[model samples]
Target chain A: LGLGLTASPLRAAGLEPNSFEDITSYNNYYEFGTGKDDPARYADQLTTDPWTIKIDGLVEKPGDYALSDLVPQMTIEERIYRFRCVEAWSMVVPWNGFELADLLELVGVKSGAKYVAFETVLRPEEMPGTRFPVLDWPYREGLRLDEARHPLTLLATGIYGKPMPNQNGAPIRLVVPWKYGFKYAKSISRITLTDQEPPTSWNMANAREYGFYSNVNPEVAHPRWSQATERRIGGGLFAKREPTLMFNGYDEVASLYQGMDLRKNF
Target chain B: MIDVVNRSVRAIPNWVLYVAGAVPVIWLYVLGFQNALGADPVDAIERNLGLWALWLLIAGLCITPLQRLTPLRLIKLRRPIGVVAFFYVLVHFLTWLVLDVQIPSQIVADIIKRPYVTVGMAALLLLLPLAVTSNNWSIRKMGARWRTVHKLVYPAVLLAGLHMVMQAKGFQLEPLVYLAAIAFLVAMRWMPLSSFRQAFVKR
Candidate 1:
């Protein structure tokens, strides 16, 4: 409790850089825009100031909370972890954010809020990809209430000692390091608590590839590819591929899914 | 140009051969920037290798048309260049099939179930016949049929290009250039002015 803002457990883990110039340069974020770096480029146009999240559906306090009023209510902390994608790739990122649980708690998730659906702002003038029907507009992502409340789950707002880059899902993005990258939605505008499981973008498009609970386990391969091993990027020509860890190197997190069958869930 | 270069002179100096041999090796060294070899090392390792394999394939596809037009006599260089192209692609597919997937049967299942993978495997299957027949013996035995046998390279090139496009979630311009070049080369095949016949007569 006596720890300084810079000396907290969150600071220690978050100190490590999650988003880098190189990583940001080679990103695949589609919310702010289509190109990998478009989020970083076009995301600055987003006015995080005076921003209000529309918390609706089954929430007891179903109303708008300004970015200022809401952010201070939630704990801002950092967590260091490897982010693995179902596409058989991974990244070791140190996130600068807080737990999703705290936000849900503050909003007072209703007893009937079994599922949580998140939405990103959709403006074709700024985000050209939104103009195209790439997926359902506003870029929707959903999580089961339990999954949303998982300790590993994060509500990231910034990276690398800076406000979130437009490319890196600036302002606010979810950091669920265990799931595939797409599961960690970016540029969030709305958070709706629902009685039934909400339809997610990826699962709706290809249910076989993405499941509601997309925890990173090697045994449960995507219908298109296995998740057994992954390459350590920038490892030279002679360097060998590394075996992919279950829960994307999060044994602490993997314990949460102990009773569940990943294969069936996948 | 072909007469001077392609002719096998037993007493010829070995340095020329070494220079030719070192092309791919030297190029790879240059590409491996500060020991970072593949694409976006910060990203997943598999993505880097996958991009590298596609780059090699693109380069290989470029060789055919470039040689036909260039005065540098690149014809003698085609087979070796192609073999290297195949090497990178082999590594690319192998990285996915072995390290990523880990089981051959799963890979087989994936190809069957996924249209993207099925298209890629089809391109690889088509490449097998070209690789097998890439010998002087096959060229001599097949004779005029050799042209018929090699014509498969056209579709092989096309499928390889499509494999890149299919795997991509969005439009990228680089793959389009490779596809365009391959299309241009295929168009040349239908020309009344054959590049092979034109190469023999110089201005």
Candidate 2:
């Protein structure tokens, strides 16, 4: 899946960068399996070469764009961000990618575009966990047009100065640092500029359990587990779980949800 | 055939089971030090201890039904199984308390709000008395009441299975298999399906 490497100078969140082993091995890629190591074990089957993302809906540039053609056009930057999972675990990842806003501008979003919908590659044969119906395949995530345009949002193509390992979403993926990790779809194959809120895969599977806007809110607990605390990935067995922060500690993004009810949207 | 196997099993000291049980726990810690538990070692440890606890609980519950149905006379192993299960449960609880939850307020709130945690805690609470009373002294003092008190194992086992099912992230077949095994063992005790029940009653 290694096409080429482009260096990014743009800095984002600051935390101790987790080891490449920790970032690659421990993941929540459901297409592989629920176990953290399942992705690293099974993701080799995923063919990321010759990938094309179909940009459609309310964009002027509505066509399939090969990832090779897209990479050279943008300035890739290294963004070290704190990634928090909805399951109450976290890792600090140094991602390599350009801003999503740059890509949206390149596509020339139409005036009617209110949301940005993303879809992951649906290759059930390659992704073994898809056979179990753990989730609706072709995992979908969305961002409000404003959130999509946020400077912090990244269209990550690599991590730790290398092309992203298949388990961590090779070729291209979305990285919304302010939201839970699931909000950033991996192995993304499609991006739709839409007028309505796109139906997210997890929300479609179980709406009450997984809300449309899965912001990291400590006050609103998952039905089965508390979101108040999260264990850091590389922390040893006796390490204490740190308290989870609202918006995952990117307080600058708090203004984006101003006057909105996170509890209701959560 | 049953008599031969039973005699052989009886020859082994019961403390052997305790030692055998400790092997996995020690092995897990060794693996932990070796970093063999994979990327997230803490979560892996939490899961490993919980799974072993659930498996041992099911195995402990299976003892009576197995002894009644066959010439196994395996009742002697039941106490060791329950005691080991209790140890695993204690470790699992501590892993969650000291490592997973961390904050005392959050732990209290999780026990109160989260159904999975509540169910797991209830199961642990139910198993406490059985583990405490596993000795011959308690058995002698309680008399007929000992049997009645130990019956709590049935409910505790079911709850442990339920906790596994609930704790699973999605539609996991492994936890469901554990639940099925528990259901089958429990049914063996109560369900008067036919000759199985008659044989059990005759025993």
Candidate 3:
């Protein structure tokens, strides 16, 4: 916070840059594939209009709802969110979407719903990434019972107005700003209230590399890179680089699991 | 083929060689001019050029081994490819050191502390001497010392591969493939012929 220009011209965290700008412009979370920017180039072809979200498992109402019918029923609000990438980068983007708690409520969570798991549509033809066992096809993410209902969580439909760019998880996506960017599963078609710790795309691949609660803690370094420092995009060479904040500037919003060894949990 | 080769004074097709080098520069200019790469053109430039540098280095390393086995005579392009790799790596280094982060202290800190940065800088540094002495005049002037100086390319390629490995999130297929190719190149050069013979027939 002491890094001068507190409310910097870059806009406070959680504000959307624009229709084209994103809090996370630098990452390999490609909608089309793992290669960075593959989604930007190829995701324009995705169809979001005729979309369906299936809500089942521990939910009381197990049924598929048309996206149009779904949107009107959900409450939409803009929340300034701090997005932390698995990479050390951090950004404060203003996100406009319905709180996920509202949606889970709409579906009516049953008594047994302890863990809420989100799923992305897996199509080899559309998402070439799912074609190979690159990750456990159909990317998956989950949250704790309390975390699911947390105010910070969101079921994002549109970003910067209009519609969510296919590259940025068109139709609908989830935003868990406190955790690593991958926690925000994109192109959501299914939501299951599971009793177990739901399998995630990254955790399934390498649990050590990517933990379930991948909060951006500088101490818990990613096996490959350190999380201590990050590059501020467009911050020309001369501009001082910013040190990564604990929990990606969400210590206020979500720093409960402190004191305990983060390295062990990580 | 022989007659046309004679018509062209140069042993290789000059225009194609020129096109090979011009492609990256022209592509970069088009991106830079249009402002299509984004607010930070330096990252785009660094990524695009760094990848090509690694690719060309790998490609250059494959030449002699391929020549030994195949009739392609890839050795001709080795020097050209080395020079291209060196140019791009210099660009990658410059974009980060000059355009993106101007502070020398931070850059030095990154090199001294960060594993990936250290490997990347080491690879770039290794390529510098090779770049400066790449010309025919230097080769003629240095004579036998040129061979000694050029041996640095092997370690440079390894360092580049290491840099990619460290930068990736997991066991990345791309970097792994590059490492495998390096392994194959090494195998072809150093593997005892008897190892291949035993694996092929004895049983």
Candidate 4:
């Protein structure tokens, strides 16, 4: 809670920042509920204090690291990022955190590690929605080692110059700006470095609809809806949908999947 | 008891049912304009209108069933309810066309490619004739044919129910409930328990 935060100059592709109201009110935190505003109403039950992240599997230094201990180890920087949801909605958010690479380095990734798997906190009592099988419990996500180590990958601890709201992944969350919003798992409690490609919750739930890579590709449309364009959050009902950019406007990330077919991977 | 209720229902003119049928759509529009329909207002409005259309269509289906089971003369309300449901379906289609799929080309492709959209459009198209011939004048002109033409509503309702079930994101209970309700209503029309009892008593 006492982590010092310094604002970074990293701006998100010239996109205007969404309002604080828009950021907090409209969310897809399934742990709290499926509805956009459900988290804001129900996430108060989640206990964020005295939290710990269990880093194990393919790590040289594997142990439970308390949040207080981890925050002090690295300088927290505010990075404004353009978050694109798989549902064709976009938001520019100011996130306060350090790089996932830094956190992985702190844990000391072992030589055999090929992927980094992330797991959200699974306290059914605190999270009322877990009782229903909206998704496989303890929502899981994974990144290829290179993607995890990339400079753009961040472990966001807060947003809008404030610690994250309970509904908005309070203690810690992954923010891979290049991938869809669901790829960035929220309320992350355990991160396991593994050799095999880990199973992501959405991908496991519906492989055709949600792919493992889940890169922001305008070409690959979800089975139910088109993803060629996205409506910017806070934009009124009549606002025209802006053309969606491949890799969410971070074209540099294309090198991450240079040879592989995105459509097949997707 | 039936006579008393029918007397009260008659006292209230048919115009009241028309206004009552319109209230939900008006409420949806107000919520949408006020930005009170949560984050995705377009989806909310579209879904609400479609659901209401399905509901009114179902309600129209129930008219004969209610008459069969009870002394209620809800036959006069059927045309008004069907007409209201047609308007709701019209608005639902418009919301999808104007809001969701702004590109005219894409809308055509969607109607052709997407099974749910095709089914929904078919349902709407099927209801058009019924709505047009709902007047007493057309009823007199068509006579025996009018009743046969209106039978299309059952298939339209079935397609509408299927459209809802297919459109849902996950295994939702709401769409399933709508389908079950329609199924029950249709089954009641075909095999009313009272009719079975009458047959048994006659034997």
- Best by the lDDT measure: 2
Q: Which predicted model would earn the best DockQ? A: 2
Residue-wise C-alpha lDDT for candidate 4, range A133-173, written one tens digit per residue: 87887799999999999999999999988998787788899
DockQ of each: 0.20, 0.62, 0.26, 0.35
lDDT of 3 by residue, A46-95 (tens): 77779999998988788998989988987788766666677655555566
List the RMSD of every prediction in angstroms.
6.9, 4.4, 5.4, 4.3
Ranking by DockQ: 2, 4, 3, 1
lDDT of 3 at A157: 77
* TM-score of candidate 1 against the unseen true structure: 0.71
Return the interface RMSD of the candidates, in order shown, one decimal each. 4.8, 1.7, 4.2, 2.2
lDDT of 1 by residue, B107-147 (tens): 77788877778877787787777777878999998999987
Compared with the true structure, the alpha-carbon lDDT of candidate 2 equals 0.87
Off by over 4 Å in 4: A1-14, B1-5, B71-73, B195-203
Model 1 RMSD, rounded to 1 decimal: 6.9
Could you tell me the TM-score of chain B in model 1? Answer: 0.68
Model 3: residue B60 alpha-carbon error in angstroms: 2.7
Per-residue CA lDDT of candidate 1, range A1-266, in tens?
46575456544542333336544654666655555556656666666666777889998788987877877877887666676656665555666888999988887887877889998777777776666565666677888888889888898987755677677776788988777788888878899999887788777766767788887778876655667776543334444555777777667766667797778887
Which candidate would rank higher by lDDT, 1 or 4?
4
Would you list the clashing residue pairs of candidate 4? none
* TM-score leader: 2
Question: Per-residue lDDT of B131-197 in model 2, one digit per residue for the tens?
Answer: 9999999989999999999889888989999998987765677789999998888777776656885
